[model samples]
Target: MEEAKGFVRRVLLLKFKAETAPNHVERLIKDYSNLVNLVESLKTWHMGKDANIKNLHEGFTHVVELTFEDDEGEAAYSAHPAHLEFHERAWPHVKKMVVIDYKPTSFHT
Candidate 1:
């Protein structure tokens, strides 16, 4: 059998302030998605809004998932100028956010 590979996955859960306008959220999504082009370490990026079907989101309404080859790649992306700019523009409107990073693992029995 082929060996399982490992990569870093960064998950960002965002909860916008109750009063944040829809347009701002849209703009943020566009800006966040654009980071993939500017940050070479980003191997993949995806974003979505909570469906609210199970009502388990708590207050986080939006999610951003980013894949990197390793933790160093993620660190480079975090320190990149484009990310800093985006963070400054986006944080004021955000009520709270949770960020988690982990190495994907696969197991077979």
Candidate 2:
């Protein structure tokens, strides 16, 4: 059997105001998924849900994970027009953002 290789992961955390429209957020998520699908360098993508709990403050509402083969692949995706468009549309809705990039420690067996 052939072994599968693990790719570098890019994680994005975004915080939006409580007053932000849910429909707009949904639309932006859909648009982001579409853009990711069109990018050949993006091997995989996943979005996480809001971690809401009663009486406690959560810093972020959304989490996005993207895997790429290498830094070059990620760079290509960053420069893609579709991604640019998505950024333009989504930036206005965001209150704050955080990003982290790292490599997988172990490959799948």
lDDT of each: 0.90, 0.82
Supply the TM-score for candidate 1.
Answer: 0.91
Per-residue lDDT of 34-94 in model 2, one digit per residue for the tens? 8667999998889987766772435687889999888888999999988888888888889
Give stretches of model 1 more than 4 Å off.
Answer: 1-6
Q: Would you estimate the TM-scores of all the predictions?
A: 0.91, 0.82
lDDT of 1 by residue, 1-109 (tens): 3333657899999999989899989999999999999999999999999998889999999999999877789899989999999999999999999999877766667
Collision count of model 1? 0
**After TM-score superposition, what is the CA distance of residue 90 in candidate 2 from its true location, in Å?**
0.6
RMSD of each: 2.2, 4.0
Clashes of each: 0, 0
Model 2 deviation from the true structure expressed as Cα RMSD, one decimal place: 4.0
Error of 1 at 86 (Å): 0.3
